[model samples]
Target: MNSRQIKLTVSYLSILLISCVSGTHYLFSVYSISIQERLNFSSVQINTIGSACNYGVFLGKPVLGYFVDNYGARRVCFAASILIFAGFSCLALTYEKIFPTSFLLCAFYLFWTGVASSGGAVSFLTTTAKNFSSNRGTAISIPLALLGLSAFIYSQINMHFFDDTFHFLLFIAFTAGLCMSFGSLFLVVIPAPQHVSDTIESGSNDSISRDDQRIEQTPLLNKNNSNTINRDQIELDIGGWQLLRNKDAISMILILVFFAGTGLMYINNVGIIIESLYHASATPHSDAKIKNLLGFHVSLISICSCIGRILIGPLSDIAKNYFDLSRICSLLFAGVWLFCGNLLALLWVHDIDQLWIVSTCIGLGFGVLYGVAPTTCSEYFGSRHFGFNWLVFKSLNLM
Candidate 1:
């Protein structure tokens, strides 16, 4: 890739990283406790808010994809960033007052955040698809890894500043505002290559020329001329539904659904698991120590998640080249890590180290899954409708 392509790639990746990290910073298990305490909410009420966010993501992805496909990525990305900024600002400002009724606040915040984040996903994937065809897998994976790093940074910030809920909200709002302002401006200039349009036109012309030559060369009296004619080549166009009907596409979508769903479940629940484990282990005498330990565990998980995101993409590229494994195998490995992480948490009774180890494992697994899944979708579906296709699969998984 040239300098421009590299710059664009880095910018998009940065935007994606910021969006994810900013949204997730306050969504971790520690925040759940803070929100509950501030608003006097029951556990059930808090869970309901989480469910709302998940369902919003499930419903919003397809709509966002369609908009991205019809319009352009720049508009969608800018708008989404604005929404994310607004959502986070709202979340930070009202989290204290919004508690049990905060379900409404959370739902609203999640709906916009979902819309914004989905746009970032589509934009980044499409940009990467446009830039590097041969190393597309690596390109996609790299951004996911960066997102992990962002998560780590955000988690640390939360851990340090989260003692005062009101102050934390202000800090999040200010940070999100800056990211949105810069991210939107940065995204506007990410030029789509002229060669993309040229290539499509050239491919279409080549198809037409080949069809004409074949028709002319064939004997008019040939019995099977019709059968020999390649309709797909002649048409030089394929619809999204036609692509979806392919067996490979169907299989790929199913795999992506499982991959995304399980990956999200882990991301959403890992902190909760750690907190609960620590809370359960600590006696009344050791409450403060256990709470501090749990905070440390959250920080470690965040840091590991960042490391995993940065490394997983490059590692997967190496694995794909060296081991000659399919992308599905990479995804399966991530899934296994998730299962093992959860199992470790379930079986290991009271050890903080065990909990931290499991959290780290889960973070690594999430990094791999997030990094590889979108790239796999692009490989199977082609880049033209990548956003729409990915959203379709992601929506299914979220549902």
Candidate 2:
């Protein structure tokens, strides 16, 4: 209810909107089949194109984070909006064979769009992490949860607004880009408490400016949190390479790699996976039926994924605050669902209907993993170097 909280609320809404639009990259399967058929793309080629968006996010994270750290998220988000707009526009044109490019070129265009989307996504995460100290988990969960819901939102949009595949692509380009532009216009970065601390301590505050003092007195820096936050910041400042040498850092990376790999394998190959399951069960399908089935599964995945992401943040807070659980414990909790999902898919998923359960668990697990990892990474490494550190460690998600 305070002005600071109000500003935080506004920023939260902006970032969530941006994330919801940009994170549609995860729904590549929805349009991949149509694209493949139209372009006469091979399976490998289609997969490569689908993976390009994520790869763009993975590869661009460090760069985007660096800009976010130095210049703040607003500028970076604006640039991202432009990139997404141009990339998608170019993609639509390419689909129409306007430039007569190969599939590789098309993949590159998608990759470029993804890079832009990553800027928006990372900006949101970094902004939230930098601004909030208490309840960091819940703060981040808001936007990230929406990001997980992107697929569902897009699915509904396609189902209701756009009838054809080609039109859907154009609409994504126009609508998502417009949303990103609006988000960029609205986003504002809050200075970190530590930075404000240093400024006040350095005699930067005039006599009448007592807000800084009140800020210093805020419970965000009490004995319980300040010590932990300071310690994390110190460890994060130990240089990225040196921090990489830490056992905790290595473990986090490996855990992310494992969970991310499990989820991404399904995401990238979702269409084929569903088809294979349908065939195995001798489920007869018309084109409309297949599309409907895929949409239903995707909707389920998005719904569960969003719910998992939103809930896990607060759950981690509970475990951390009440049970004195470490970040690793929160991570292991995430791994539980990932393991179960994969296990069910591998051992028991012999029919189309059973794949529904697998998708739910996998989506839930993936969402939870993404939800907590960034703030946890910032806690372990330090918020100062969070951008680069998170990017490096999180590359495992792409793998």
Residue runs of model 2 more than 4 Å from their true location after superposition: 192-239
Q: Candidate 2 — what's its lDDT? A: 0.77
How many steric clashes between backbone atoms does each model show?
A: 4, 1
TM-score of each: 0.79, 0.88
TM-score of 2: 0.88
**Candidate 2 per-residue lDDT over residues 1-399, each given as its tens digit:** 877778877887888889888787777878787778778999989888878888887889888887887788888888888888877777778777786658888899889888987888888888777777667788888788898899899887876777678678788888888888898776886654565465434433342243445543333324543322222222235335786789888888889988788887887788888766776676666667667777887888888889988998888777766565776776777889889988998899887887888888889888888888887887767677676677777665665
lDDT value, residue 328 of candidate 2: 76
Please, what are the lDDT tens digits per residue for candidate 1 over residues 1-399? 997767866775555654454334324454566666667777777666665666656677777677766776667766766776776667666675643345677757766665665666676566566555545566666666655565456556766657666666566556655665566555433544565445445646664566666644543233443344332112222236786678867776676676556656656665566556655665454534544554565566556655665666666656655564567777787778777777776677465456667777777777777677776766656666766777777778764
Error of 2 at 69 (Å): 1.1
